[model samples]
Target: MARLTALAGGLAVALVLLAAPAMAHNHPSGITDLVTPAVVRVEATAHVDITLLDHIGELVHVERSYDVPIGSGTGIVINPEGGIVTLTRVVKTDRDVAVYAANRVFAEHHKVKIPADFARHKLKDDVLNHHLQECYPPKTPTATCIINVTTNITVFPNVSPADPKGLKADLVKAGDTLDSPAVLTLSGRVLGSLGMPTAPLADKVPDAAGSPTNVAGFLGRPAPNLPFTVDIAHLRQGGGGDSQGRQFADPEKKVDEPVKLGKLIDEGFLGAPVIGDKDGHVVGMLFGGGQDGRMIGVREITAALAKAGVAPRRGAIDSAFEAALTRYHTKYYTEAASGFQRVLELYPGNVVAAGLLKISLQKRGTAEDAGTKGAVSPTPRSLPLWPFIVAAAVLLVAALVGAFLLWRRRAPEERVEEPPAPVATASPQQPFDEGANPTVVVRRSQPFQVVPRQQPLMTANEQPSVKYCTECGMRLGPAHRFCGYCGHPIET
Candidate 1:
């Protein structure tokens, strides 16, 4: 009983020890909870000029259109006017920029003229046709429509200015130093852009000082989206040069170190938000393909946007924008376009959703045209079923034949062959008289018998038992009353 009790106690202790680590590992951190809401997928469609260097030392420039998609990157809603504060690199464009708000609302160019006949046809199908008819004109046989046209595109959120409490505005009448970072508010919540509270190096930094930092970004072409991230070892102050200056000056150099983001958040976290450890504020964006992983600070992001003469704006259309984005991800382009259009109706200045909406509308239009064409097309004739039936019949006949042949080959040999009868020899010739019946004499063979020959009788002084049987010279049984073969009796 004592041994059993000790064994049970040990097992209980072991189980408790095993469960402790799992509970700790599964506990969600403050950073993950805080930044998940602000994370948004930035989807862009742009024409990238590809330059190829051939073996012959000739450079070929190819202008190809590509859809760029960035998923689950950290972003901030700066204001109620639908302005979003995200990494400029996240929305950078050689040709165009489109934003997919957290609510899935799309901001894109919507000023295209819609033909009367096309609009009427689309409206006949559904109210959602407005999105398609407005952006893509039906192609006429006489005049081919150019589907891919290079347009200067910009996107912004439609944030209403009336929300007093959420609105954050820097009150600079005419001449203010504007030394500190600007703060904006939306829905009465004060918002800060990437550059707001810059991260500074702490004291007592080690000689070989570098801390793990997460970088997230979108990879591959946008049509089929691929998102990924990398962890980088952020160096101390003046260790690997300033994070701000080094990133822009040498984007290639930062791609050379292996990033260790601890075991908890490692691979498959591409395009994940990287938040500040102190306040859980988003401070950087990550891109894949760097040895240590590529990351750009908030300062660099804001600076890039300033260069492009654009600022982050979040507005009333944000909810609708996010909804459209969700629809797009779900592959409901029709619904997505409607959602994007609702956003546009609310905020006409949102270029991100406007551009994406144009593409979505075009896709929807083409799909409708294809569907109509398929409906009008003739049904093809199917081949006769007789061929299959005939083949099956032939196979059945062949199987029957094979079975019969197999049975014939395996038949018993005794059943197939019979032995010949023996011929009889003529008896002694006794047929001299032809008239009288001939009588033939036959000799019978002697029966097999054991006859005992006479043997000398033993005297009283001698043994009475016989040494062996006289007929067959065989030994007698131990307690035999008579010989087994000839009936000769023997004394015990």
Candidate 2:
């Protein structure tokens, strides 16, 4: 019976254990879903070349180029303006610039030619007139018709010169020579000339903490124009002052330790952007260095461009771009590609968006030019409580049924009774019972007596008797307390 009861109890425990995992799976936390859309891969066409220097400190321009295959990083699209703020270093290096658009079209640096016309004026002089001695066609001997070609001519033939459009033109003129600018094409409008600059964090538009940010870039070498997503774990406060007045963290810090952006998005995302998900505004650009990811703030981007005399205006490419990004996060890759293409159609220089759009298209198992369905706002996944409640109810019913069955089975067992044992009487003994019930024969125990042994005292001529403990050879007192050596009591 005991074995049967133990078996039933074990079976009941096993049933409860089997149902726990199902309950937990139905109710996942909300944080898991929130981060899916905010992550992105950053792609950079890294034109890496090594410049060897001569002993005299002059640049020994090695007549060779080390154009490393295109690199990648993660970045965020902060605002609706087509301005995709990423690390300046990513697009600012001494390499040719190319931004892949959503339509799978790589927008490269196309040298444009503008027609220019100039007029040159000059004077022509006739030194001496030669005499026509023979006289050709019937004319007076003194009369002479002189034909002369003037030295003034307006040269208006088609003249086209390749000149960088924006701030770069200002820097590389006759008087001042400046670095080439990073440029992006948005909706056929040139967005920038020099690379984006870094500014102070306090100067940027306020962004709340815990706001969702996305990053897109490259990890290693990606196939030509492939795009991917990067995971952004978190962001923290970081900045420092130096001897060069107030130097903000951006391109300069990239060569040093990996900064905050580097910590979150490391080597692969050398120049990705940290963008605010709320409005798709680029908040920070990634820099590769430091244990943690490093990035420069958006304010720095605006300030740097401003210093170069380039005013960045918000474009219409942001909404569609974000919509596509949202689709990609939701695993709606097909729709995402379409959204990215739409953004590219409006803004050409959005490299990050263009790269991702192409990837989203590829993920959907479709070609880059394939049509996709329109996207609607997704319904948030709700906590599933009914399944857990039903499971609990079933468990409670099973336990109650088990208890009822057990009680019923125990009720059928019969009770048993046992008879009590009889007491025995003792026989009486006959003695002087005739007189007074015979004074019961009494018996008494005798007291024990011990014999004492006596020892003779030593005379003056003989040595006094001395007692010693057998255990440790210590002397004992005549009245003998306990032996000091082994704590044995001595007889008096």
- Best of the candidates, lDDT: 2
* Runs with alpha carbons beyond 4 Å of true place in candidate 1: 1-30, 47-77, 85-148, 151-208, 212-273, 304-492
- The local distance difference test score of model 1 is 0.36
Worst 10 residues of 2 by lDDT: 150-159
lDDT of each: 0.36, 0.37
Compared with the true structure, the alpha-carbon lDDT of candidate 2 equals 0.37
lDDT of 2 by residue, 206-299 (tens): 2333334555554533334333444443333334311111112333333322344454455556545454544444555555455555445666
After best superposition, candidate 2 residue 256: deviation in angstroms?
18
Candidate 1 local lDDT, 1-492, one digit each (tens): 344445545555555555444223122222222233233333223432221111123333222233333221233443343234443333332322221110011011222233322113233334234333332323333211123423221221112221122223211111111111222222223332221111111122223334333333223221222322333345333333324222211234454343443221223233234554443345554434333444444564455445434455434445666667555544346776888898667655344566668767776634332223333321232233444445555555565666667667865532423222222232243112221211122222445544443333334665544466566555553233344544445444
TM-score of each: 0.26, 0.31
